[model samples]
Every structure is written in structure tokens, then in C-alpha cells.
Target: MHRLKKSPKNARKTPHPKADIEAIGEGRRLAHLLRAKRKEITKAEQVRRILDTAHNAHEISLAENVIRSTMHPADQFEAFARLHHEEGMAAEDIAARFGVTAAVVKQHLKLGAISPKLMQAYRDEELTLEEPTAFAITDDHARQEQV
Candidate 1:
């Protein structure tokens, strides 16, 4: 069994093996699920071995928890729009590729149709995501911008 050396500052507070085992189990389960879906997740990609000496583990944990964020809705809409118009992909095809329902893809496409000015406002944080989503009711750029 591998043992994590306790930090000198907290010699009594060593990491629990049970927690590490559970984390590994969860990683294996995720790998299996992704593999079943034909996603290319190699075993190495599923579980990474981090040397305790290579970096500060606490810092890594903090970064993982704090630095990650979901893609902005406007950016998602633009990507879907590009795939639909520039790549000539149908909504259903884009949906399948992204593992989303066709309706969701259609909604994104509608959001993409919002006026560029409104989209810019959203990107600039001047408008909330819902504001642009509401503008999606009309495809006319001039009409959307007017609102």
C-alpha cells in the first residue's frame, strides 16, 4: 500500500486511503461510461498519477475547485451557429455530435439569430443571458436590436 507522507505542519492529519480508493473507483466508472459511448478516453486519461513532490497538492485542489467555469451561453450559441451555417451541419446533426437534444440545438440556433449588437452586449456583461434568449423570439436583426 502506498502512503502519503504527512505534511510537517500537520503530522497527525494524513490523507485517508479510503478516499483515494473511492476516487479511483469513480474515475474507472466514468471511463467505462465514456468508452461505452464510443468516446476516446484512454486509461491514462482516466486516472492521472500526481507525484506529491512535483507540485503542492493543496494548490492543485484549490485551482481545480476555483478556476473552472462553464462556457458562456453566447459562446455556445455562436459555436452552434457556426456549425450550422459555416459547416452546413443540420440542427439534428449538430445535436448528435454534441450529445444534446435537437430542440436544445434549435434553441441555440435561435439564440444565435439574435442581433449582433445584443450578442455583443451579452458578451460585455451589459445584458444577462436570459435577455438575449428573449430576443431569440424574432429572427429579424433590426427588430431584435430595437428591443
Candidate 2:
């Protein structure tokens, strides 16, 4: 009788001993963990490359524009309203962009007209949110300052 030896590829994947099988599973798990670690290291290296690279003039300009567009909501809305009004855009059109009624846009424009001191006071948390609205009810800067 002749015995035929199994090639490495054709050999049984699991050992007959339970301990050997468990060790093989653990080794597979460790290999998977190492692969994940390697992927994370590659991602970190890519981030470092992006941060260390010198940006061109256009890239810098784009970054500046993005930063400028990140103004506080109140200030940003006021600026948008003011520019729209200055550009002869209809109140209704501007209101559509703001997703508010024309009346609300008009009221916001009124609030936008308030003195810078009052606006700064509102921004500084020194005055309640309603205080600015009350000031907007009257166009008198003297009265607004008094409040």
C-alpha cells in the first residue's frame, strides 16, 4: 500500500486537536487586527500630507471666502438683507430666499437699522433677545440708546 501526502493547498484547514484550531483562529484574528492598524496609519499619513502641503493662491482665496461666509447668523442675515436692498432686489424675493414672509423681512430690516451699540449689546449677551425687537419698534436711536 502506498500513502499519498496532501499538498499544502489541499491539506485540511482545521487541525484535529481543539487547541491547534483555536490557535489558528486567534492568529487569523491577530492578522485582521494588524491590517486594520495599518489602514489607520495610512489615513493618518494622508492627513499629515494634506496639512503640510503649501496651498496655492486660489486655494488660499477659497479658504478665506469660506471663513468670511461663516459669520454669526444675525450679522450674516443683516448683511444679506442690506446688500439685497441696495441691489434693488424686491423685498418679497429676498424674503423668499430667507424662507420668511415679506413682513418678517421688513421687521428684520428694521432691526438691522438699530444702532451698532445696541447690536453689540445684543451680541454681548447684555440684553435679552426681545430688547432688540423692542428697540426696532421705534426708529429713534436716542430711545434705543436709553433702553
Candidate 3:
């Protein structure tokens, strides 16, 4: 490849000895530089694209609100009450996995919207509620100790 001869027109195009020398480090010289710069884009352009995507998501979330939040503050407590208060999952068992309080679980039970039968089941040991596969509590201090 080093021995390959260039046409007179090629010499007329780029008449620089340094360009030829730099072809080894800079990849085939002047023509490549022009091509690479033309191909490159900017980070600002990528971020603009991501923000456009979020704009569409925000619109949908505004419509669904509570349902959109999945397990919100009160929802987390309610789910726990069903599992522990009704299903007989002990306070410790609920706390170990959910990382919350026995009292908080009880509070959610009182506040939740589940069926009376289900609530009674958790309390009576007649039925066991399965903990949600995954959930989050929007309540920050519920799990936090006060004293």
C-alpha cells in the first residue's frame, strides 16, 4: 500500500507532504478530517431529544394522577395491612421485607380501601394476603422513627 502511486490530479488536490506523513496517525489526511467533522453531532442535540420524550410522558401522567403513581403513600400502607393485618404476616415479617413499621402497617390497614372480608382475614388468620411483588411508599416519615 505504501508503494501505491497517486495520480497527478490527486497531487493537485492536496499538495502537502505533512498531510501524507500524518495519514498514518490521522487516517488518510485532509479528506478524512472533512468527513469525520461532517459525521459528528453534539450532546446538546441529544438532551433536547430526551426532554422532548419527557414532555409527552408528563402529559399522560397528569391525566392518570393517582393511578399513575402506582403505590403512593397511603397505598403502600394499605397493601401491607392486607398482607400482615389480614393474611397474618407478622409485623416483623412485613417490616423485614417492606422496610416499614408494624404501626405503619396497622395504620395503612385502618386507612386502606380493601374489602372487609380481606381485612378481617388478615386479622383473623382465616386467610393470608400475599405481599405485593414490589411496591414503594410515598410517605417519607412513616418508616422513620420519631423518638
Candidate 4:
């Protein structure tokens, strides 16, 4: 068996009219330049920047803070509950998907149903995690606001 000769790294598949003048070597460099143009975003690094700037500058903060903090217990529960309640998913199905009990799903749904203002405050750390429980116990937004 005869071994085939390997092509040069800088060789172009198709011969261009300007190949001699411009050279196939530039093609490899151009390909590398194009690849280097891509933006690589590390989510952890992005979140760290957001968290570092959150207290100092509100304008530069991440709009989706809940998503950035992927492991926060309350965020997970609230997101699942929101999916179930707002998206019309069954609580049992949500429980099955999340590996939690139906009662837990119901509890999260109740918490997710709290007033948006209170929820935002909770997210911003202005209110304690448990503070929303009082509001969640009742269905009335007006009543929740009163308290």
C-alpha cells in the first residue's frame, strides 16, 4: 500500500486566480482571524461582574439576576412554580419533573403567586425569604399590599 502525501496546512481546496500574488498562506491566517472574532462568554464570569456591580451601579446590573444565580433554592422553586402556574402545567407533573412532592409544588405556586412588588423586593434582598409567606397565605393582592 502506498501512503498518500499530506496537503500543506496553508493550502486552499480551490485554486484562486490571485493564489500566487496573495498566497494560500493568507487563507489560513484569515480563517484563524475569523475564528478569533467569535465572542466567548463565560456565564460564571459574567455573573461575578454583575454581582460585583449590583450594589455600586444598578444600571450595569444583569436584568435576569434570577437566571444568573442558578442554584439559589428560592429561585429554583419560584421558577418551577411560575412554570406550573403561569404556563398551566400540572402541579403533580411539575413535582415529577423537579423530583419534589406535590405539596412542595403547591407551596412554591403559592409563593410565586405573591405580589410582583414583594417578589422583586425578595429578589433584590430588600425583604427576607420568609417575608413573602405571609402574603402568599392570602389570595388578595390588595390585602397583601395592606400588610
Candidate 5:
């Protein structure tokens, strides 16, 4: 039977080897995800390299895992509204940029046009998303707010 060799019991390990391994794993995972989604090998490689070269790679990985969140629906509506009204971007253009359907963009536009008071209510969790979406069918801010 073959015997496996083991390191000396007192051998010193590399500094923060666990952290380094975690950072490398996170970078590889992100690179794989980006490549799979965008089909951009160069961009994926750049992202991986950037993560690998960070002074506190493990901290960055931890922050990304712990702090990052999906954009809130209300925030998305407001952003889409701003792009359409303030930036003069059409629903189709916004849809293309966001990888959503034009119909979904239109829905967001409608929700964005809702009364500011109601939007605030939505943000505060006083109203459900469906309620605001229903109100979006009308352009009358006063009527929407009154209801």
C-alpha cells in the first residue's frame, strides 16, 4: 500500500492562506459568471485580475457577498422614469440597455409616473407593489394620491 506524505507538524503556513483561497475562488466564480452571461472573455479576465490584485481581496469579496443587493422595484421604476423623462430615453432603448422586454419597460414607466406621495408610500412599505402598479394605469397624480 502506498503511504501519503504529510507536511511537518510545525511547518508554517502562508499568511492568510484561507483568505487568499477565498478571494481566488470568488474571482474565478465572477469571471465564469461574466463570461457565461456576456460572452466577453477579455472583460471576464480583466475582472478576475482586478479582484486578484486588490490589496484586500478577501475584504472586497466579503463586502460583495454581504452588502450587495438587487435594486428595489421602486428604485427601478424611478430610474426608468428618469431615463425616459429626464434623459429622453425611449422604453425600447431602456429595455435594451437593461435586458428586459419593452413591455416591462413600459410598465416601469407607468409605475414611475405614479404620484410622488404614493411612490414614497411604496418606498416606506406602507403600500404593496401591486397597489401602486394598479394606480399607474392613470396619469392623474392627484387622483392616484387621493385613492
Candidate 6:
């Protein structure tokens, strides 16, 4: 059995396996724990978690991507929300696309405004969304009319 080392200060904590410690994979195996977490999870849970995490990550990533290019973050979220809409994503899902809570996305979605430029930036960066396409498009047509 291998003993596991404690995680760093900022890392999210994982369940410490009392028994698996000795058998855990030893390489600098945690390049990015999220990647490894993907490997360890079973299929049913994988989809849900990947989507959630992806959404959160995408939101932060989207913010940074716009700033680096000297673009407006508000405009960036709007554009992304639109493209995601094109791809059949829903308001809650679109909110997740940027890793924010549904309420947060709703605030952005209410505006008739969307940023074509930021959508382009999102595509250029190949950003990943946390919510799946299925959820993204849920009630989409209705929302489009409202928007």
C-alpha cells in the first residue's frame, strides 16, 4: 500500500482512500486533478460533474479571454450566450456555459443584447461549457422570443 501525500493549500480535497493509498498511481499523476477526476468517475456522474465544472471553468476562462484581448467582459458573456443559443443551449445552461449560477445567466439573458465579437473569441479559444447541449436548448425557442 502506498501512503498518499496531503494536497496543497489551494487544491480541492478528494476523498482520501484509506485502503487504496498503497495502490494509487504514482507519477506526477495530478497534472490537473480535474483531468484525473474525469478518469476516476463513473459515466453517470461524469456527465453531470464535467458539465458543472466545465461551466464554471468556462465562465472564468471566458472572462480572462476577453480581458487579455482588451475586450469588454459584459460583451463577452453576451456574445457567448448567443453562440451557445445558436448551438441549442438554454438560459440555465448558457449561464453554466460561463460557470455562473442560473440566476446570474438570467441577468445577462434578459437583455436583447449579445456580442458577436465575443462569440468569435469563445470559438477561437474553443471554450468548454459545463452544461450539456440537451439542457442548453431546453425551452430555448420560448426564451428566444422573450429575448
Which 10-residue span in candidate 2 carries the lowest summed lDDT? Answer: 43-52
Model 5, position 64, has a per-residue lDDT of 58
lDDT of 2 by residue, 65-117 (tens): 45323334356446655656677777688789768888877767777777778
Global lDDT scores for all candidate models: 0.72, 0.60, 0.45, 0.62, 0.74, 0.43
Model 5: lDDT equals 0.74
Residue 104 displacement (Å), model 3: 2.0
> Which model, 1 or 6, shows the larger TM-score?
1
The alpha-carbon deviation from the true structure for residue 43 of candidate 3, after best TM-score superposition, in angstroms, is: 37
List the RMSD of every prediction in angstroms: 14.0, 27.0, 26.5, 21.4, 17.1, 17.3
lDDT of 4 by residue, 8-113 (tens): 5322322333424332233444455555565443323322111253343332233333222234445655677667757789989988987999998888888878
Model 3, 43-101: lDDT tens digits are: 22331112334345555445444333232333355566667646788777877777777
- Candidate 4 regions off by >4 Å? 1-69
Q: What is the lDDT of residue 113 in candidate 2?
A: 78
Highest lDDT model number: 5
State the weakest 10-residue window (summed lDDT) of model 3. Answer: 131-140
lDDT at 100, model 6: 76
Q: What's the TM-score of each model vs. the native?
A: 0.57, 0.47, 0.27, 0.48, 0.57, 0.27
Q: Cα RMSD for candidate 2?
A: 27.0
Q: Which stretches of candidate 2 lie over 4 Å from their true place?
A: 1-73
For model 1, the superposed segments whose C-alpha errors exceed 4 Å read 1-67
Clashing pairs in 1: none
Give candidate 3 regions above 4 Å deviation. Answer: 1-70, 113-147
Number of backbone clashes in candidate 6: 11
